[model samples]
Structures are given as C-alpha cells and as structure tokens.
Target: MPVRHPAPTPPFNIIRMSHIELGVTNLDASRKFYTEILGLIETEQVGNSIYLRGLEERNHHSFVLTKVERPHVIRLGFKVASEADLDSMATYFGTKGMATGWVTQHGQGRSLQMRDPFGMPLEFCYEFAQAERMLQQYGAYRGCHPQRIDHFNCFTPNVQASHDFWALELGFRTTEYTVSEDADPQLWAIWMHRKGNIHDMAFTNGAGPRLHHVALWVPTAMHIIHLCDLMSTTGYLDNMERGPGRHGISNAFFLYVRDPDGHRIEIYTSDYLTVDPDLEPIEWQLRDPQRQTLWGAPAPKSWFEEGSLLAGANVQPPVLQAQPIIAS
Candidate 1:
C-alpha cells in the first residue's frame, strides 16, 4: 500500500527531531560515555542536568542527561518552525484531547510539552540557544564523532496506530516498513520521516511506549568502525550491544551500545535520501532476516525484547506478538 500523507497543511510546522531528555542513575558515568568516549560536545550544565549537542549541531543542546533515581526517558523533542508554530502545536494537541503544557527549562525558549494519543512523551520548542559548531574541530573530538542527532526508534504495542498518528495526523511520510505475512497481514513496523532524509522517528511492534534507541549520525562508516575499536580496548566492549553492520531497513551503518545506565544509543551513518514526495515506501516481510540486517546477521534477543522505559507511560501489550528470526 502507498503510504498516506496528512493534509498538506498541519496545525504546526515541525522542523525536525531536535533533542532528547533522559534520566540516568549516575551523572558522572553518563558524562564519561557521552562526552569523553562518544564525543558529544557538552554545551552546558545546570544542577544535576547536563546539556550536550552533536559536533555539527549549533543548537546549544541536542541531548540532555539528568540525575534521577532511575534510567528512563523524559521526552523526545522536536523543533517547530517558529514561536507561533509552537503555540499552534499546543492548540492542536490540546484540542485533540491530548495533554499539553508549557515547560520551563534551560537552553531553550518557549517550550511546549505534550503526550501523544499513544502516550509517547514529546516536546516542541522554536527557539534554542546557539553554540559554535564543532564540525571542523578535529582536535575536540575525544573518540568517535557524532555529527548530529538523528532519528529515534521506539517500541509501540500497536505499530499501525502509532504509524497513523504520525503519518495521517501529523505530516510525516513513510519511507520504509515491515509487515507480517500472516493470513491476516499486519504492519509490524514503520519508518516515517519529515526531515527529507530517511526517518526522524520509527516505530516497531513490541512492548508499548518504550525507547528502543536514539540514533546519532556520524560522517561515515569508518566512524562506526573506529568506535568499535575504541570500545574493544577501553574496557567497554561489554557495553556494545549490537552491530557495526548495515540495517536492511534504513540502509544505514549502525552500532548499538549501552551507557553506564543502560540507555541505548545507535551510532549511525549513510541512509538514503527520501526528499521526493512521490517516493514509495519500501516494504519488508517480518520473517525475512535481511529486514533486520542487510548482511544477514540475525539480531540478538535483547534488540527486540528490551527497550528503555519512559517515566510512567501507560504501557500496553502488543496486539500481535512477533516471531522474528534471532541469533542462535
């Protein structure tokens, strides 16, 4: 089926996936992983929270780590086109019977926070504090360089409903998807994007409303390989969860690693462009092993069975469970 597009005009103009806020148990340990090892540039620190951005990002912060009792996601952030768009965002969600409110926080202005119909926490802000870009600052890179914040992949009980909310309600366009080929075929996953590359966020069939991983774009595949070598010798090899391999879905080079608090981050590169509105979304059958990894390696069980919790989300069970091919 061709992907459905929302009306040409939406209530607000969402620019792109902007940032993420995560609560971690150990601030010092998280800092060592993100800043010292992974090479995200620290922009600011306030109380128990630390603000960081990718090397090429000019936004004062694109990732926020805060000290909390548990490791959980606070919210995923989006950048709207303007302050007026921010207001429109609040109005649109509020009218939809979704929870919306203004949030006061550091490093950004006029932030609006909301929970989607599926209870995935989200925030939108128009103005952000700008910082010097570090794209050319080779010496500043501690190890593998994450150029910018990319897409987020998450687990939702109902991939179809989650896909509709983003594709038919908001204006995100699907670029790729996975479907079960059962007698009654069902969508098992959807990758939708607004930023003109591949995806800004993706939803996979699994437990309800949990973060699978947040991705950061690097310059090339070599960057990912470099990270693997760094971890292998740095006593963090155990933290490496999955690939330095290409994904059959996005066609991006990927590496998954766990932070000290076990929050997952994917170091990624090289997804194809999806700028043309007429681009047909690619489809893959659920049981096909290539859909998980293009080079034919089966995913580890943890990749499907585990995801980080969002604080107090109304979690639900998947309507239909998957029987994916996993490593033996």
Candidate 2:
C-alpha cells in the first residue's frame, strides 16, 4: 500500500511539551528510579501518582509517573496556544470520526483527550500552572538537569497512515525521513515537528503504534555522563540501553534506558535549533551504520523491541508485524 501523507500546516507557534504520563506496575519503585536515580525533584503527589520536574525548570511538572494497574503511557500533554484551540481541536477530531474526551480543572489546565486511528493517546490543553525555576545556583553538575520534556518517537506498522493522522488532522511537519535503498521504497523512519527544532516527534516502521521513547533535553553533554554514572552507582546500570554517543543526524549526545515496564526514555542534549522557514528535511540511507550511531556501537536488540503502550479507557490492539532491521 502507498504511504499516506498528512497535509502540511505552518509551524506551531506556542509553548512546547509540558509533561508525559507514564504508567508503572509499581508506582513507588518507579518514583524512586526517577527521583533518586535520575535526580528529578518531586513537585507534588496526589494519591498513588507523583509529579516531577528537573530542578532547573519552574514548570509545575515535566514528568508524571502515575500508578496504573498495568505498564503503559497514559497520555502526552502538549501546551496549546489557548483553551479555544483545545475546543476547536476536540470538534475537529470529532468531525473526522475520532472520539474526544474532556477533563476539566485538571493539574495544569482543562484538557481534552483523543486517540489516533492507530491508537496512540494524545491530549491538548492550555491551562498549565507555572512554577519557579529551582536550579539557578546548583553550580555546574546538576544531576540530569533537564530543562523540559522535548520530543517522543513511536513505532507504527503503517507509518504512512500514522503520519497522515498526525500531519493532516494535527499540525505536524516532516523534518527528516529514512528510505530503503532496496525495492519497494518503504519508509524506514520519519522525523516530524510541530513548531521548530527539526522534530518534536518521529515515527518508525515497526510492530504497532507504540511509543518508542520520550526525549528529555539537558543543558550540556556533561549532565548525560553524570546521570549515567549515577545510574551505575545506584546499581541500575542494567537499565542503560545505549548511549553517551553523538547522533549523526541531530548531532546531539544521547543515552537510552529501559524503565521498569520496558519503556525506553532518552536523555539527550546539544541538538541544533531549527527555526528557519526553509529548513530542509534530512534523509539518511537505511543501510548506513552512521544512521544509528555516530560513535560506532550497535544498538542492543532490547532497545529495538521494547516501547510503551498507549493508554485510555478503551485501549486498542497494536498493529503487529515482524521486526525490521536496526536503523544502522
């Protein structure tokens, strides 16, 4: 089948991502892993759930680990331009035959939730409460000192279909793509963005619509090494999936880890900014080792196989398929 593409819109002009809700089998263990090992500060706690953010950020919370009966992703919250946009989006998706749900007076703002055709959970809102920045004088080596939750990558069996839903219905633009050199012209990977910085999200051809990893941005490369060392000392070295390497495309330092539920989370830094109207999308050959890792180490099998499931009241089955080659 031919890959379906979404209609392009002007780049997003608003605040960036706010927080990502992660579902964990054991909320306490997951909270320790993030707060103690990763050095994120706990901002608030409501019953079994805990809200966290980097010490450097003043946002209410950048990461929310919720206590769910199972392991999965609850929803990814993006700060919209205004509450009006949220209502419009809710009606927009409704017109397209997608169901929409609303949450009033929630954590940061009143929000609306929906699912894509492939079953990924998405939420949009404008009611977030801001906090004071807390790391002004931590002096050079704040553990994991991430500024904000940046982007996420997901796997989709029908990459083209998922791309169309995000790009056409939502307002996302393509920043890069991976094309197979062999026959069939299959899309191996696609980097997409909402407003700027090359990509805020990406899609890879894989088993189903699963979240591959959520990328958090740190101020410098040293923070990545510090966090890796911390993970090692805390006896969580086994969680380190890959990393402390430069990416051939983003030119950023990256480290990947598998949380308790096997969901991958990336600690990334130093990628260049993309704010120009004419920024060209980068295309990498599927067979190039440089495409996977700029420093030459191959990504482990687990990193390729594991990801977070989407969450909502009515969860959908994943679009299953055989695994493809590792990007390199």
Model 2: how far is 237 from its true place, Å? 1.2
RMSD, each candidate, Å? 1.3, 3.1
Q: Evaluated with lDDT, which candidate comes out highest?
A: 1
**lDDT by residue for model 2 over 4-70, one digit each (tens)?**
3343552333345567888888977887777666667777888877888876677688788878787
Clashing pairs in 1: none
On a 0 to 1 TM-score scale, where does candidate 2 land against the true structure?
A: 0.89
Q: Which stretches of candidate 1 lie over 4 Å from their true place?
A: 1-8
Each candidate structure's TM-score, on Cα atoms with residue i matched to residue i, is: 0.97, 0.89
lDDT of 1 by residue, 24-136 (tens): 99989899899988999999889999999999999999999999998899989999889999888778777788777898779999899877667888888989989999999
